[model samples]
Target: MHETEVVGLNVQRRRRGWPTLDIGPFFMFFGIAGTDHGREARMERRFEQEYFSNAVTLHLASALSPGTYALHGLPEEANKRGWTVGPQGGNPTGHLSADGLDELRGWMRRTPSQRDRRVRPERMLPPA
Candidate 1:
């Protein structure tokens, strides 16, 4: 089966893994570092480390309207795509289908800050 490897920030990675349907053949990885900035370079380094032939990485910076970042191996394709992120359409290998890419593009940031925050009930006093 075809696969499009997806590596996101730790929190983002976890959020998608649990309580969510696995999108197609997309695989997730975490702890690549340099996610806050220089993500493209980091992604390239990661690609080299993993030796992926047909894989894509999605780094969500804003997670707002259009803060999504998709690094590409080709400049021409990247220019043609415009602010859009993810793999090119009609990928036979299923590295990333058009609809799946669109789904990824529509994703929004669930966390308020760079790091994933959680509330702890243990820290709060018991109710009166």
Candidate 2:
């Protein structure tokens, strides 16, 4: 997935989508606990240097969005009630799925323009 894709998802949806995410390997400086010069302060700087030192954090975050350190995806099909509140109850909560493995029951109900890439999915939503 990409940053624009992640930008389209809410916190709940993001959590539902990437349930097994782990930050330990995405960045080399991860797990910086218990250091000599205050791990909190050093970790803060490490975050800045790793992500904001360049505008590439967008790509980094996006790439990290779809990963996991262990098992991936839901354990069963019946666990998808979380997507019921989405714009289209049948529409999958995933943004960039090629096959829409996470798509819900009414996937075909929405018009093609509603899924157009010319406009972002989140941009189509009503104001929160």
Maximum-TM-score candidate: 1
Q: Where is the poorest 10-residue window by lDDT in model 2?
A: 52-61
Candidate that would win on lDDT: 1
Give the per-residue lDDT digits (tens) of candidate 1, residues 1-128. Answer: 12232224212111111232333233334533332356466556554333322233434322213222223322323212223332442211113333434443334233446333211111122238
- What Cα-based lDDT does every candidate model obtain? 0.30, 0.28
Q: What lDDT would candidate 1 get against the real structure? A: 0.30
- Candidate 1 residue spans exceeding 4 A from truth: 1-55, 59-94, 108-128
Off-target runs (Cα >4 Å) in candidate 2 are: 1-38, 56-128
